[model samples]
Structures are given as structure tokens and as C-alpha cells.
Target: MLRMAAILILALGAPAAAEPLARELFGAMAKPSAQAPEAIGTYARGCAAGLEELPESGPTWQAMRLSRNRNWGHPEMIRFLKDLSLTARQLGWAGLYVGDIAQPRGGPMTGGHASHQIGLDADIWMLPPSRVNLSRAEREKISSISVRTEDQTSINGNWTRSHHALLKAAASDPRVDRIFVAAAVKVEMCRTAKRADKAWLQKIRPLYGHNTHFHVRLKCPQGSPSCQTQKPTVAQLSNGGDGCDETLQWWVTDYLEELRNPPKRKKPDGPPPKSAKTYVMSDLPRQCAAVLSSR
Candidate 1:
């Protein structure tokens, strides 16, 4: 009897098997929570409730990679994408080829992003649609063209005035917070923009690996009190001026040089930082538990 008791104590004292990662839990959900819509934390660390799915195909847009089922987003994002697709028509393109927005419940995804966790971000393909009626097979096989050249120093022939007009219209929208594109594209826009009409250029930020598509992030919708708004960048904080200066030049110059010859550094002597893939449920906002468990 004493021996049996000792085994029971050991079993009880042993740590429980680890809970699955948050991305695994959220990614398994194929539907949004049954509660009212809310964005519950920062873009990189949060979950959303009551997300709506964009239609697989629309009159002016088509959601790509339907197999991923990542076309879900907050209603405001759906409206914004539809509106932007219509705007693309004015530039003589058929419409936009919409990319991933977020998973149905908007938590850390299984792969492919660090953000898109709160349902206000989306990817718009640089490849304008020749037609919005692409077969599912065609979308999977097709690819977007890079506006910048392979060297990353300048815009290639694929970049056009229509692309400029489309980007300007998007950045000028009151609902948008910022747009991310390749650095070279921003430099070209800065060069060609009229001095009197350059205010919207400030929203066009340069980031690495956006040569094939641009990312659009929207402001928090009016009703989401728990949503965390992203802070402005240093360029945006500087007197509301268009970001057309030396800082922009660094991407093609010093940034490229570092990329070509990366400097070695000592590894930090601790556990690695948590990212979307590494996050567990506790790493997300408390309310995410409700979002994840809700039917």
C-alpha cells in the first residue's frame, strides 16, 4: 500500500504535458468565434473575434491561396479591400489580387507572418489582375512580378505610372495607416511626385522583401476599445513632412552593402525571443482564451 501511494504521488507531482503552441490551437479553428467582433491586442500578438471572410471571388477582386483559408478579416478590412479593388479599375487594371489577411480567428498563424494577428492588415499583389475570374489552380501557379530590379537599386520596367497612381490613391485613403513596399519603389515615388502633392508619400514605408506585393495596414475600427494602435515611426513624427530624405537612401546604399556581406555577431546567452510561431496562449492577451474557445 505504501509503494502504491508513492507511485501516485510521483504521478501527481510530475509536470503536466506541455500545452500545444498557440498557433496550433488557432490554426486548427476553421471559423471565427460566435461573439461580437473585436481586435484584442497588438498586431503581432493578439486574437480577433467575429472575423468575416472576404468572398472568394468578387466583381473587381479575387482572393488568392484559397486553400490557406486566410482570407478572413474584420468587416472594415473587407470593405476597404473591396473599395480598393474598385479604385484599381480607374487605373485600367481589372482589379487587385488579394492575398492573406488573417486566419478565421486571427491569432498567431501556423506560418508566414509575424503580424496579421488582429485582422486589420492585408497584402495586395503588385500583379494587377488581367481578369478577376481566375481558376483556383491558376492562382496557385501564378506569381506576382517584382517592380524593383534584381539589384534592388531601382524600379524595373514593370513599374509604371498606373502603379504609381494606384499606390497614391491607396495611401491617400483616410482609413489606411500605412503601406509597405520595396525601398526602391518609395524612392521612385519620391522622385516623381509633384512637390505640392507629396503628403501621401509619408505613408509609403520601405521594408525588406516586399518586391512582389505591398502590405496595407488599417487604423483600428471605431468600436474596438481593446485594440492597440501602432505608434508612429520617427519619419512620421518629424513635422508631418513626406519621408523623402537621406534615410530613404540608406536602403539602397548601406542596407544593400550589409546584405551582401553580413557581419558576424555573438549569439545572446539566453533563450531566444518569442515570435508568432513560438507564442503560446499565455503570451497572447487574456481575452484570447475566450476567442479561441468560443464556438
Candidate 2:
């Protein structure tokens, strides 16, 4: 009787207060806020203001997945994409098939990403474009090719010299912070690149699920004082070397070995960690609420 009364008292003491998910709030916004452009927090836990949308069709590029409404980015990012597409044209390809940049008002997306909450990250499809005039339906129907082999040991026939040149050019750019590609792609590039021309390899990081599209993250542009830079900068992470030796080898060797022979471990006793999808508005910076509420 006492336990029941206690439970009843607790239940009746206060009303249930369930805050909505941040992604829901941000995702519901159909347009950017009317404010000066700024990146407000870390890539995975922030919001952007005054983001510009990349045109769906440009002379040198086409933004795919029109249904996702994720072609928006900062002005600097837009300029960089345009410049890179032009470089693609100069390299004998029609142009780039640009993938997701960010949502209209950059924040935690409803789905399909965890780090594009800022307007500085972009995904460039691996498939070299034959044409940049793809219709909305075509963009949705098409899929990018995997540059790596099925076993993930090395690059496939689709990995061409033009790809190497394009990635090298992107990594060498001043605005770029880092580029993420499959481990095999990095290994192949490392093997073929000349010693003197390999400095940019440090910025080419190896990540999983990037065989179809390489991700590019740009440095915080000028005027975005609130933008937080990624810690342990590329130079620091690489220890001033090109990271072509042990780091690249680990992916194919130990990583693959671990995958084949799974290690046994005890699960921790706790609730699951919070991710972009689970975040509430309070998990982000104070400025984000203002950005969300802005006119």
C-alpha cells in the first residue's frame, strides 16, 4: 500500500515534460534564417546561419538528390565546389556530381548523416560525370560506383588516373581541412605518388563507406567567429609525416583481421550514447536556439 501511494504521489507531483528532438526542430525549417552567415558549433552538434544553396544545375556540376534538400552550404563552400568542378572540367571529365552539402538551415538532419550539421562538409560522388544536366528523376535513380574492390583490399579498374589527380588537387587546396576516402584508395595513391609530391597525402584520411563518394571538410571561413575547429589538426594527427606507412597498412591488415576474427568483449551497463538523431536543443550551443528561432 505504501509503495503504491509513493508511486502515485511521484506521478501526480509534476507533469511529463518531454522535449522534442533537435533534428525534428531543425529539419522542419524550410529555409535559412535571416542573419549574417555563421557556423555556430562543432560539425556534429551545431547549426548554421545564412547558408547559400548550390544551384541544382551548373555549367560544371550538378547537385544530386534533389529530394533531400541538402545542397545548401556556406558561401565559401559554394565557391570551393564551383572551383573544384571547374578543375574537374580541366581534367577531361564533364564535371562533378556533387552530393550532400548540408540542409537549408544547417543543423542535425532528419536522417542520413551525423556530421554535416555545419555548412563546411560536402560529399563528391566518385563516378566521373559524363554530363551535368541530369534530371531530378535521373539523379534519384542513379547511384555512384565503388572505386574499391569487393574485398576492400585495393582499388578496382574504375579508379583511374583522373581520380588521383582530382583528389590530389582537392587535398592541396588551402580551404580544405581534410578529405575522407576508402582506405584502399589512400593506399593506391600512396603507392603511386612521387615522394616530393606526397605532402598533401596527410589530409587524405581513410574512412569506411566512402568508396562511393569522398567527403570533403573545409576549414572555418573568415567571419564565422563562433565556428569551432576540429581538434588534433591534420598536421598534429599525422605527426608532420604523410601517414602513408603504418596508418594505411593497418586498415587492410589488422582491421581486416579483426573483422574476420571478432573479439569478445563485455557490454557496458548504461543507456546508449546520444547521437545527432537523439540530441535535444539543450545539447547544442545556446546560440543554436537563437539561430533556430531567428526570423
Q: List clash counts for every candidate, in order.
A: 0, 0
Once fitted onto the true fold, the runs of candidate 1 whose alpha carbons sit more than 4 angstroms away are 1-17, 233-238
- Cα lDDT tens digits, model 1, 1-295, are 3323323433465332244577887888888989898888988999899999999999999999998999999999999999999999988999999999999999999999999999999999999789999999988989998999898999999999989999999999988888999999999999999999999998898899899999999888987898887886524553588888777888889998898899998999998888898887777897887787777
**lDDT (tens digit, per residue) of candidate 2 on 152-246:** 88999999999999999999999999999999999999999998888899999999889999999999889889898788788888898887978
Q: Candidate 1: RMSD over Cα atoms?
A: 5.8
How high is the CA lDDT of each candidate model?
0.88, 0.88
List the RMSD of every prediction in angstroms: 5.8, 6.5
Clashing pairs in 2: none
Lowest summed lDDT over 10 consecutive residues: which window, candidate 2? 1-10
Model 2 misplaced regions, further than 4 Å:
1-17
